[model samples]
Structure formats: C-alpha cells, structure tokens
Target: MEHIVELVGRALLAFLIMMVIARLLGKQTIAQMTYHDFVAAITLGALTANLAFNVQMKIGHMITVLLTFTVIAYLLMILALKNRSLRKWISGQPTMIIQNGKILEGNMRKLKLSLDTLNQELRERNIYNIEEVQFAVLELNGEISILRKPEYLPVTRKDLKLKAGRQWFPIELIMDGKIIQDNLRQNNLTIEWLMSQVQKKGLTIAQVNYAVKSSNGQVYFDRYDDQMPNPIDKE
Candidate 1:
C-alpha cells in the first residue's frame, strides 16, 4: 500500500539524517557524554522517532526543527570548548570522593554519589578493600578513577630487577581444519613441519579445529571434539 511505502521511506530518511547529524556532532562514545550532550542525544532520538512515525507533521518542518536543534547543540559544544567556565558548568568538574583511604562524606553528599554506588564502582575497578584506596575521583562522565596505595599495587619486573621475558605473538596456523598458508609462509614454516608438529601430538591437520604457533616455535592445537562432560561456562 502507499501508506506502507511512505512509512518505509520516512524511516530510511530518519536513518540517513541521524547518520549525517551524528557525523556533524562528532560524538566519540556514549560513555563520554557531558550533561548537555546527554540532553542533546535524548532530544535527537525523539526528533528522529517523530520524523519516522508522526505522519501528521510536514516532513520539511520536522527536518527544519531537527536540524536547527542540532546546530544549536553543536554551537553550544563549540562555545563550551573555548570557554573554561562554560565547559565546567556544562560537563561538571571531577570531584574527589576518596583520599588517603578516607571517604569524603561532604563531597559525596554534594555530588549526590551514594555509598552503595561508590562501593560498586570501586569493585568494578578491582579495588575490593576501601581502606587501601589512595585516591578515587568521580569523573564528569560517571566513571570512577582510582589510584591504589603503592603497597597494594602489583609488583613489576623493574621492582625485582629482572629482565623482561621474550614477547611472543601467537600466529594462527590452522582454523576450522584448514591450513593457514599465508601465516606458515610469513613464519618461515612449511607444511611438512606443520604435519610433524601435529603428528607429535598424535593428530593430523584434519583433526585440528584450531592451531597456533607461538614465536618461541611452540605449536598448540585445539580439536573439534573437546569431549567435555559439562562445560562450566554453559548456562
């Protein structure tokens, strides 16, 4: 029917318009959205939805409003970037909630960041013990940035005064029973050497579901039939 065709056309138009506007807006990630960006995003989504289904409004008028709103948001974003005070107001300043293993209850109350939320965020960053946190700041984009006490930090090779081990990048030699000829050639390996490696493990190229050769020249294999009684990860 004509109505169905019109709806389809409008939906496609909405998609194209959103794609263009998104490029113009230059949003890198939803997680990085400021308060103004968040509001603009919601407004854009609503406008696009209306453009898709609200047949009562004139399409030209609908597009005009959407484009106008986007221009205003874009201009505001540009101005926010140039002015430090405006940026601070729009994005909000990062607030420190934890310092020297002590929770700042005053900052928490002012930012309306709940203790439960703080604990959850800390756990997400693998900081199980709050007493060990050296510093924790609530970022503008609702992410918690934490610095652990030096004592709680993981030991590094430099600390032990030991040379770093050879870094070996794994190269795929076989996948889905097919030999990766390009990888073999790049790694200076031949089919004969590959077959011998497979045979050492009492398997053939046909038996391997996947295979990889480490830079250390160690070849590993995975078979088609794992014969697992119960995969622990299966829900």
Candidate 2:
C-alpha cells in the first residue's frame, strides 16, 4: 500500500512539473519543433519518466537536473530568437527542392529527401504534376512549401478587377489578461488609448481574454466570458 501511494505521488509530482516546464518552454507543437527543441523535448520526457519511476535516484537530485536542463533550453531559445544567424544555425534554412519546374538534385541530396517523398508531399497539396511547381522549399520543420507557376496560380481579386480591402498583420494588444506593452509601443499606441477602447466596450483590460489591433487600425476584443447564445461548438 505504501509503495503504491508513493508511486501515485511521484506520478502526480512529475505531471505537474512537466506541465509547468512545458508552459515555460513556449508553444511549439511537435510538428513545428526545431532540431534543438526536439532534442530538449525527448530529454525532458526521459527525465520526467525517470522522475516518476526511478526510485533508486533521489527526487531532489533528479529535479535539479531537470530544471537545469530546462533553463539551458529556455536560454538557448531566447538567444535563437534574438540572433538571426544563430536562429538559422539552430533551426536550419529552408532548402529549395524545385525551381522553375526543375528539380534541384544536389539540394535534395543534402536534405536526403527522396524524389518519391517529394512527389508524395506535392501530391498531398494536390499538385500531381511537378512541372506546375515554380518553387518548392523544404522548410526546416520537414514540411514542403510550394509556389505554383504564375500560369498555374489561382485567380484572385485582381484577376476579377475587384477592389479588395488592405490587409495588415494583426498585433496583439492584450493576451491572457496582460497588456502587450512592447506591441502597443511598436504601433505607437498609448495605454490611455487602450484603456479608453476597453472602456468603450464596457470592459476592463483584466476582463479581456485577448485584444488585437486589426485592419484599418481597429481594435478587436474577445472577452473571457463571450456570452454567446448556443455557440457552434457548444463547449
């Protein structure tokens, strides 16, 4: 009974620690993890499992090791974000697999991406004919991004001679009840303006789940309690 209780306690501790560490590590899905991120994830998983089951090892010692590794990994990620060259070195640059309907055999050799695999990826994107590809890049995350030839490209608003609304990158002003000061400053906005906007919406910043400055410099808010009637997902 004591052994079982100890095991359960260890599992719960490991689970909580892993959750906290994962949140601190940032939000990159398995498909988006870079090489370093992948290595860190594997290492962390091993350490977490050992922390739960390795009764021979002292828990404090194992936790210390795990935390130290997490710190190193976090610091590396921060440095990578700030340093473009370092980021490229860590995550690697995208490789051009196809250009102007011509396959880059040498580049594919370097990536070890077989023609069969390339064809498979292209087919998944509904590009059955490689000749239609103007440019196909193998991204660092092992996904292929393809640009169709101009002639093969889909018709857009311009093709129909229709006016289109200008698009802008959405800037986060508030996320998870916290103001994004840097983003606000980047857009030459002030807290007074942000507060006034929130006030107009009958909300305080604390009550907002997220807020963004979108197209035509409009502020969009998503409150924590949306108060929608019968939401589509019904969650």
Best by lDDT: 2
* Candidate 2 collision pairs: none
- List ranges where model 1 is wrong by over 4 Å: 165-235
TM-score to true structure, per model: 0.72, 0.68
Clashes of each: 0, 0
* C-alpha lDDT (0 to 100) for residue 178 of candidate 2: 95
Model 2 superposed RMSD (Cα): 6.5
Per-residue lDDT of 1-235 in model 2, one digit per residue for the tens?
9888888988999999999988998787355788788888999999999989988888999899999999988988888889999989876788898988899999999888899999999999999998899999988788899999999999999999999988778889999999999998988989999999999999987799999989767889999998988779754
List the pairs of residues colliding in candidate 1.
none
Candidate 2, residue 199: the lDDT equals 99
Best by TM-score: 1
Candidate 1 lDDT (Cα, 0 to 1): 0.89
